[model samples]
Target chain A: MVRLITHNLLACHAKGCTQNNFPLQFKDVSIELKEQEVNSEFVKNFLPRLEWKALVNTARQLGDTSLPEELPDMVDDDFLKALHHVLFEIHVEEGAMVCPNCGHSYPISNGIPNMLLSEHEIG
Target chain B: MFETPLTNIDYDKVYEPAEDSFLLLDCFEQEYQSIQQRFTGRVPVVTEIGTGSGIVTCFIKQNILPHSIFFATDINPTSCSTAAETIKLNDTHETHPFTFTAMQMNLTSAVRSNKIDLLVFNPPYVPAENVPEIPKDLDDSSWLDLALLGGQDGMMTTWEVLNNLENILTPEIGIAYILFCARNKPDQVAETMKARGWKVDVVIHRKAGWEVLSILLFQK
Candidate 1:
């Protein structure tokens, strides 16, 4: 349930949320990387939609220190492999994703995160 | 692939037949061969929207060339997991280069905008007399309500898929291969695709059967 694609759209849906709150930072997250064969075409196709800084930072927090600070001009096999690992392999089996601005916590259990907010939190 | 009529055999009998009866029929082997022929060349990235038992997926992986990447998805997580397990069972060597990711995703939310090359769907197209009783197995999830029912005319799910195809499919290079029933208004589907400016083709047509599975290719 915590796919990076879904993670990109999720924000702190709490009341009175404003300004740079989202792309919530992961807190004390546990990750497992199941390496899949790198598809350079897919990686190249999906690069535009990726949030470079957020992804790199999240990967770093999850103990993957392979990506560069900035995306390189020529994306080689090595870069794509790392990108693949960052995107698909790492599964967030446990932990909470906290919104830096609003201070909302989305908890993860059994690799599935409960994103539904309480009645009071609903806008 | 050979054409077979759904009415030729009793639905209930074939659905839950005896072990000895299945041995004589060899339905699995025939289905496997049909699936293999579909993915033999140019190894397209295939995404199955309603991969029920994962039989088709396993068949494709086993017989097709090694380069194809299969993403088997279902609205039901349990169904997705079952498919994933089947994939693991069939996959002997990791070096075969097949990656099967079973994900719980709805049609509206799951797929990225204008990204998929091919979409395979075999939705529930049997139109009901009244809103049929929601089966106990599907009561746990809300998706089954819309996913299985084809609306008043039994083409509701088919229409939904067509509407979605307009957005998810690129006019220049996308194609959606779907299967529907003969009693479920195939003309409406063809008309919808034509109205949406897609070149439609009837790849497979079965005679004297209620379940008429046609692969509609939507191209620019």
Candidate 2:
């Protein structure tokens, strides 16, 4: 499935398409939200390792403008809650993650993204 | 003992948890204290490659590491969907324990480098004449062959996962548990991993019918 948490870790691995392949752009996504208690400690620990710009842009693409373009000097509970929602709650039920460099489209059907490359695309 | 999560899994299409899978779970149980100690403070990114029934991933999440995010990948779309169901069934407690995501992809190819803290793989370790072709279509059931057949002493696919470990695992907190059978040569595999400068051990082993199954633990 396409969650920002998982999406953050995925890069285009099709053949030799290497440069600027990260943060696969979301296109035609069906978003689903589930309510869960925000764990501040987890969110805080994970925030430092996240790609801030990619996450913000992806959330915005999913019609969620809760995150800021830049992380604040001191992230408060509101920021942590927003990060938790963006990372854990929102799920892309149906869509395609297109590689920015390679132009390969990984289709998401039934909430699972098919990252299998074609025969010619396998390196 | 953690209950095996195999609810709603069509065993004919997806892999059914067997002795190899149980041996992996046993090792986790045996090393549960150490595992908990290793990841006590942080929210580790735990991933399982080739999640057949998603039983091992579900077990680790529900029982061993409740405070982690999990990513599971399977070449077989059926296994991916089946694993998602297994994860959902185990994560239904009101607390909403862990965030899990499944992808249909090759082993560890879709995951980012140095992001996974704990990795688990139960690769296809049965010696076979040929490594089966990976199914491409969404509804293709031929992937069940890829779930079990391992060419050249069942090491074809296993080697791919092992070689990619250095890139997939977080250097500080990475620990991988991989299953190997006697025919696949467990001792030699451990030696190879040790040669790669990893701290390796046969964490658990059991004689299951004709096959001798062992779970090889690796740390970077």
Candidate 3:
């Protein structure tokens, strides 16, 4: 389940590949919308931990450009719902996550991510 | 310090907080004081391999090291859902917001090597008499086979982690708690620890039914 929230924390870890690793790019991503029971408090609670720029950019990349160009000064129900939808509801079922710098790609299939590196790629 | 299953779906599929799970919980729950004292000058990068239900990771977050960034992996896709639910449910309480993520991955695969501060694995230690095929989640089945089956001698999954520990673990700061019972060869564990230049410290040893389980903590 490669949701925007999970994608927000991922960085490239290919052997000897360091710079420009954070927020690996999604390629040919297929999104699945799952409707979770909305818990507004949980969404509000998680607001601080979010990397707003990374998340908004990711949402745009997934063809969901609903989020505001700038984070709203105060969160409202509509905004929170959008955040919840982007962070939790969207799932990348099939795709590849490519590093911006190294161009190393990790594929996601059957909704399971293969984060394994080759023996030589192990640092 | 365990989050009971959030729902029936989780209870039926995910591995619950059993003795081995609680042992790791107790090891860190009771020992976090000492761990913190020793780590006064250091920070922790905690990860749990085969993080069935994500209770142990949540337990670590709420009870032990709340600030550490936790990563978890499980082969079963549903387990990831259950784990994310568990963290979201349990982490909603009074404690600080925890940073944790569950990925459907094989052991230590997606996680970057040499970055984990504490790698926890209370693996499927029981030896399965009739080894079951890995579940595809497309048919009528229970994937608990992967949860319980540890091959002939019960070292199948643990062996893989032990072999890859060198590449996955942080060089000097990494500490791992690998739990095993009477059947898993202790000698092989000693050899693995020796190869890593880490002395084995038994964090906990107790009888859970017929098996005497030991949660071995080591550093690399």
lDDT of each: 0.57, 0.86, 0.74
**TM-score of chain A in every predicted structure:** 0.88, 0.95, 0.94
**Poorly placed runs, candidate 1 (over 4 Å):** A1-29, A35-54, A94-123, B1-45, B60-70, B96-99, B129-148, B207-210
Q: How does model 3 score on DockQ?
A: 0.14
Give residue A11's lDDT in candidate 1 (0 to 100): 58
Q: Summarize candidate 3's per-residue lDDT along B21-99 as a digit string, tens digits.
A: 7677777876778777654544465788888878888787777776555678887777776777777786555443234
Prediction RMSDs, each to the true structure: 7.7, 1.4, 7.1
Every model's DockQ: 0.15, 0.76, 0.14
Candidate 2: tens digits of C-alpha lDDT, residues B55-134: 88888987898888888899888889989998877666747436788888888887878899999999899899889987
TM-score of model 3's chain A? 0.94
Worst 10 residues of 3 chain A by lDDT: A110-119
* Order by TM-score, highest first: 2, 3, 1
iRMS, model 1 (angstroms): 6.3
Candidate 2 chain B worst ten-residue window by lDDT: B90-99
Clashing pairs in 3: B45-B117
- Write one digit per residue (lDDT tens) for candidate 1, span B39-114: 3443455566655545455654555424554666565544555566666666666653344555544443333455
Who wins the lDDT comparison? Answer: 2
